[model samples]
Structures are given as C-alpha cells and as structure tokens.
Target: MEKTVMIDGKQVQFKSNGATPLKYKMQFRKDFFAEILKLHKLGKLKNLDEIDDDVLGTLDFEVFYNIAWTFAKTADSSLPDPETWLESFNEFPIFDFISELQEMIMANIQSKKK
Candidate 1:
C-alpha cells in the first residue's frame, strides 16, 4: 500500500510492503509486529474518541513514530535517518493519521479468506 499525507505543510509519501517489516526491524531494532500489537486496540476503534484514557495511557506512543518513519523510509529510500527526517518536519500529527498507517500495516499482514 502507498499513500501521500501532508505533514508540516509538506506532502510526504509512505508505503507498506513485504519488506516493510524487515526495514522497520533493521531501522528500529524492534519487531514490527510486536510494536503493532501494542496498538492493537486502536485497530478496533472506530474513532479516536472511542479510545479510553486508560488504554491511551498504556500505549507505547513511540511506536507510532517508528511505524510512520518506517513507512516513509520504505517509500523514499533517500530519506535521511528517522530522527533527522522527523526533525525536518516542524510537526507530525501522528494521531491524526495513525489509522491510515495502521490500515497499510494490517493490509500487509492480513490474508484474504475465501
């Protein structure tokens, strides 16, 4: 899956594919699926408002940045290291777009049942 989202007034590209998890593991040194499981509740919520404060409080928020950067890096190889790339942006509203990123992640892992 591929998408372009606006961040800090710039259009940034992101992609998720078979290699995305490998790339994430290489870059972040953490298992992609494990990190994703941390946010599993978000996957089931219909909206941010549906998230309980207790659940939100328990989430490892850094995973959001890691996953976002991984997808961004996968889409554009020339993007600098994650921190530097993120520094270039004045703001990155990960919450505003995490659902989209999660969809891409889920698509890469889910299989169709027939």
Candidate 2:
C-alpha cells in the first residue's frame, strides 16, 4: 500500500484498493494494454527472445484453438463457453489426448524411418 515494488532497480507504485467490478474490467484492460503498448513504444518492454526463465509461463494455444474450433467445426453442436471449457481442459481428457497424440506422432516418425 505505502511501499513501492522494485523493477529493474526502479520503484513502481502500488495500491491496496479493492478490485474493480466486471463492467469496468474491460476499460481497465484497454488501459492496461495501452500502457503495455506505450512502454513497448518507449523501449521498456522486455525482449521476447531473451526473456527470463522465471517469467516464461507455459501456453498451450493448440488446446485453446481446438476448443474454439470444435464448436465452429460442428455444424449443430452448441458453442462451448470459453471459461467452462478451459476449466474442463484443466480437469481431464485434454491432457491425456495430447499425450496420446505425442506418442502416436513419435511412433509414426519411428515407423517412417524403418
């Protein structure tokens, strides 16, 4: 609340105020993204090629695209809610499916070399 958070040896401001409501969240996001873009313009954004290991978080875009595309792929299936679908992905079969796919690809590659 009173103290500043340090980044690259510079003190950044902090606030202990309650979270903003969902209605205003989008505006906040726009402002946040705008600030990111501004900093990027100001040459403050970190280099993607040389990002720190601790800051590198896993992102499975294929899983996300699969979930989104499935609804579009099926002519009659109801579109899946992104939030709930994401929850389901974290819960089960998706990870297993990806594992099986990895094995299948490995086997196919091995088979082709023979």
Candidate 3:
C-alpha cells in the first residue's frame, strides 16, 4: 500500500509489499492525515458507534493501526511525551474504532504541539 503523507517533518516513507511508487504512497498518506487533521480541527472527527465496512471503508483497522504504529515508532525516536503515541498496545473492548483512531490522531497532534 502507498503511505502518502508527512507525519513529522519527514514524509511517510514506509514501503508496503506493493508495486506502488514511494511518492504516490506518501501523497496518499499525506492526504489521509490532512483530511483527518482537518476533521479533527473542526472537532468533527469522532469514534464511530460501530466498526463496519461503511464506517472504516475498505481500510482495515489493522492496516490503519499499523501505519499509525510506524509513525509512533519513528516519532518516538525524537519526541518524548505521552501526548504523542510513538507506540501503543492493543486494548480490548474498544467499542468504537474511531475512538482509538481519534486517540491516535490526537496523540499525533499533541506531539506536534510540543
């Protein structure tokens, strides 16, 4: 899959097992974060009541979490704070997928703020 976005000062550079270009991947990821951030800034991004194809779309939570994990791992190398996720363990009873995602996004923003 293409990881198109700039998580930190650096662009998303992870290469998934696909025949996609690095630039394309980064651009897609960049757009994803941009949208997520925009919605977040508007305070519209929230946890969905449920996890279904209509909710998360074709994007599986596993894939999304993995990407977030990569960013957290890399960001943690330089950032030192709980605000930024850097890394997170799998928790159960996460009723809403968006809640977890929102947390991740918040952590990313919080990390940037500091």
Candidates in order have lDDT scores of 0.84, 0.30, 0.38
lDDT of 2 by residue, 1-114 (tens): 122333334332322212211212332333322222222221321345544454334333333233222322232235344455345433433322332223322331234444
Estimate TM-scores for all models: 0.87, 0.23, 0.29
User: Runs in model 1 with CA error above 4 Å?
Assistant: 44-52
Q: Which scores higher on lDDT, 2 or 3?
A: 3
TM-score of 3: 0.29
- Pick the TM-score winner: 1
Candidate 1 accuracy as lDDT: 0.84
Give Cα distance to truth, residue 45, candidate 2, Å. Answer: 31
Query: What's each prediction's clash count?
Result: 0, 0, 11
Ranking by TM-score: 1, 3, 2
Give the per-residue lDDT of model 3 (tens digit) for 54-92. Answer: 545533444344344444434334433422343332342
Model 1 pairs in collision = none
Name the top lDDT candidate. 1
